[model samples]
Target: MQEISYPEKIDPRLHIYPSQEADRLKSRLLEHHETGILDAIGRELFTRMDTAGLVPIFVLRGGLALKDAYVEAAGFGPAGVIVPWRARHTEDPTVSYASLPVVPGARYALVDTLIASGRTIIACLQALRVRVPGARVDVVAPFLATAGRERVIADAADTHIHCVWHAEDVDGDGRMVGPGFDVGDLVLGWQGRHLVWSGERGERA
Candidate 1:
């Protein structure tokens, strides 16, 4: 079993929970086709996050793969106010689709499978600022790259970021290196193809 490691000193606002299951899942992500394991890991992560009083409100398109698990672990109903968001471009991400509800002063948790470049999450934060001003947002993910962590902290200093696993950095293609692949694409059935939305609303360019 490969041991999980972390930096000597991590950001105070960033929370990382090392899990043996997550370690196994990371390896499985490279070879497995089924998402049941991913769902299981997501459930555990969300369940742990529930203790922090985080409420599920917004989820990115790739995060839909773990929606069911989050809903179950967080004890939220299927009809909960979890809005789906899409961010385009890594250089300067822009929200393409997100029906954010106006909830000033409300604290929200934004969900995503992984944070590689941090551009997508940054864009989501920008959109939330416009649609739901004065809202406090905490980002949740199963895995996070070191570069992404630094970028998000620098860009959104007030945001609290949580992750179950950590990667040393991102690869040239902007995928987490420890895992060496895109978790979102693998679980969402878009492996080896460009990452795009593929849910009830269908794939968007």
Candidate 2:
């Protein structure tokens, strides 16, 4: 949000150990940076990236922002409906699909808020596999929790991550503290088929 000049390569965080002040700041970031830039990223994907032979995946609850961002910035293909296994024991939201099955010939861009141990993303990805075996896909999460990214990379060797930012703990204090790492500040545009880089000066230069 602070004039994103480069992509951040800071390590990601997996746990949610937010302090009150951090919470307040995160709230502000949500209002200003996270939400706004999401729209910008999705629009860029639509107009700049190839969208012909892929599916847009929106995981429930958290996927709302990604969905809105995409729709507002760049309406891609028709979204194939899917909901994640919500954290157990909460009153259920009205789910469109009582049950969903993976359908082949489709690619999924798994959408979510941030990565954490990839429990959520892995679950969603597995569910897609269950519904349609061998479904080709990528993930479009808003940000990459540094901790989760390693596991994601380990679990799905071929999985791709497109994110607005990549948060990390530079001090190695085991928490995302100090100046927040901004991956967008390091790279610009799609860096590879699996990941896109943005906010980096090298690209502009």
Per-residue lDDT tens digits for candidate 1, residues 68-138, read 88878766532223333344333455565665444434567778777887877787887777776677888
In terms of lDDT, which candidate is strongest? 1
lDDT of 2 at 5: 18
TM-score of every candidate relative to the true structure: 0.77, 0.55
Query: What tens-digit string does per-residue lDDT give for candidate 2 at 101-130?
Result: 344566667766555446666666666665
User: Clash pairs of candidate 1?
Assistant: none
Model 2 bad stretches (over 4 Å): 1-49, 86-104, 169-205
